[model samples]
Target: MGVLSGVKIIEMVGLGPGPFCGMLLADLGADVIAVERPAADAGNPRPWELCSRGKRSMVLDVKKPGAVETFLELIDGADALIEGMRPGVMERLGLGPEVCLARRPSLVYGRMTGWGQYGPLSQVAGHDANYVAVSGALWLATQSGQQPDAPPGLLGDVAGGALYLAIGLLAGILRARQDGQGQVVDAAMVDGSAHLLNFAISFLPDHYGGSFEKARPAALGMHWDRPYLCADGEWIVIQAVEPKFYAELIRRLGLDQDERFVNEQRNPAAWATLGDELSVLFKTKSRAEWTRLLEGTDTCFAPVLAPEEAAAHPHNIARDIYKTIDGVLQTAPAPRFSVTPSAELVSVPPRGAHTKDVLAELQINSKRTGDRGQATAVGSPG
Candidate 1:
């Protein structure tokens, strides 16, 4: 049993963050039942997909006559419920928050959407990048000359959308456990993405003129605190932006006596030239060579690694940051506890693979036993 063992969460399946939140809960030991549509395809079954690991799945064709009853039955004892749909879609299916809450009064109702339940753009069809774009997040990432590149949409979908919704759902569960009451968690992808821009937004003047033309306080800007390419073509990130750490970085680079680089209080003018020089200097050494020289220093340097590289890194391997289950590698449960740490990965089920078993546990059996589950999911991926 894991830390969230026995906790029940029903995820009304959708793309991106919805699956991700369900995966997080399942990883932490919740009985996450992904209520997928029978017609929905559950993407690839690769364990490295990261967000799709650690979930049990069921397929219910809600358009069928008795599917709504089945949904109500599944939610009777659920502790939390999450759905990512436009405003009225769930209501049309008779599985909206109000109906589910009426069935299970203590259910933590979580709604994930691009805009929100009610907003000017609530019904607009958009994805992660579009959601983050209107929130001023994409603007902050633009370089001095280049166009603002898409940030791969991770912030709004996974980090902002999924992670925040997971946290909120867990928090709501704790509160419901204490107060014998439940509440709604309005987790909007745009809202979460906007909240992530707190640092940048704070620097902006509310009135006017303090637009994107402004730099990021020099101390926090990407000019001096970004990735530089190494001789091996891999990137090493350096972020010693504080004065003391800057001094340390200068000393490590053997530039302590350079008059222009020494004046920490007024060095913004030289940032352009210094950044160019450091770029050339960094490219002179491979990532491995620099690791030996800067490992324990205050330079705040680290080599950027790809997913496969990260899984096999010495530090990650030493920390047991990832685990293998059924020959497929995946990240371990996180935010660890000393006394009640979470369980490691057991196995990742294929889509709709647990339909019969879960339905049997729910006492909704159609009396067929052996191989019935596999038979039902014959065309589904596992």
Candidate 2:
């Protein structure tokens, strides 16, 4: 049994982070019921939607006759409900928070959006890039007077949306359990993305006497934490920042005799030159050689690991960070527990594959259904 063993949640289906959130919840042993539109609306199935993994599915034509009642019936028994629709869409469909709360007072309602529920851009169509771009995140990437580089959508969608939503869901679950009451959790990507830059923002105040652009040369910036190439075309991250760590790095690199590289304060002016010198020195050694020299040391150094390499890492493999499900590789449940560990992946069902099972669990009759076959994908389940 997982920590969230008996918890039940109703997830209104949407793209991207919404489904990812539901997947995380379901992975933690919550009975996530993914409500999908009927075949009439989207007859062509989305089989390999990874978000639908670890969840049971129910198909309801919200536009049809009794679908609203069907949805409420599920919500009536659920402890939490997540939706990613626009602000007024759920209300228009007669499945708003107010109505759901009236039915189930202790139901934690989670709303996921790009701009949020009440902002001016609430109704606007946007994705991960748009959200983070406006939140000063995209603007902060350029170190020099160069064009801004897209940091990919992971920062906004996965980190900001999926991870934040999961945290909110868990926190909401805790509160609802302890107080016997539920509240709305608003997880906006823009808000989360902006909050992601909180640490960097702390150094940008006027009292700090310098802007973020000017502070790039500081020791705490990404310039110091970036990856460096090794002799074998592999990259390694060296965090020789603090005095002690820098001293250890110097010892590992056998550069103690270099007087200029020995002084931290004086090294700032020659950072570019020193960086080039260190890069050249690193290129003379392979990643394995550097690892052997600095592995257990306090140098704060690590090699850049590919996904496959990460899965087989000593620490990760010891902790069982990845698991195989139906012959496919995927991540295991995170945030381990001393007791009541999260359930391992038994099997993943296809999209709409669990319609009958879900409706049956809700004590609804599926016998009278027409020739509505189960929906499944080839590679993976969402």
Candidate 1: which pairs clash? 350-382
Q: What TM-score does candidate 1 reach? A: 0.86
Global lDDT of each model?
Answer: 0.74, 0.74
Cα-based RMSD of candidate 2: 4.1
Per-residue lDDT over 136-204 for candidate 1, one digit per residue giving the tens place of the 0 to 100 score? 766665655566666675878877788889989999999999997888898888888888877675667
Q: Name model 2 segments beyond 4 Å from true.
A: 38-48, 203-210, 214-224, 367-382
Model 2 C-alpha lDDT per residue in residues 1-382, reported as the tens digit of each score:
5778888989888767888889888877888988775555545666336667778876666654555666788888788898887777888778888998888888899988888889788888888888888987766755556666655667787787878888897888788889878888889888887888887777677423466665542333332445689999999888666778787777768877888667742344667677777789889899988888887789889988887788888888998997777776788877788887887777777557787777776676654333342321111011
Worst 10 residues of 2 by lDDT: 373-382
Give the Å error, residue 6, model 1. Answer: 3.0
Clashes of 2: 4
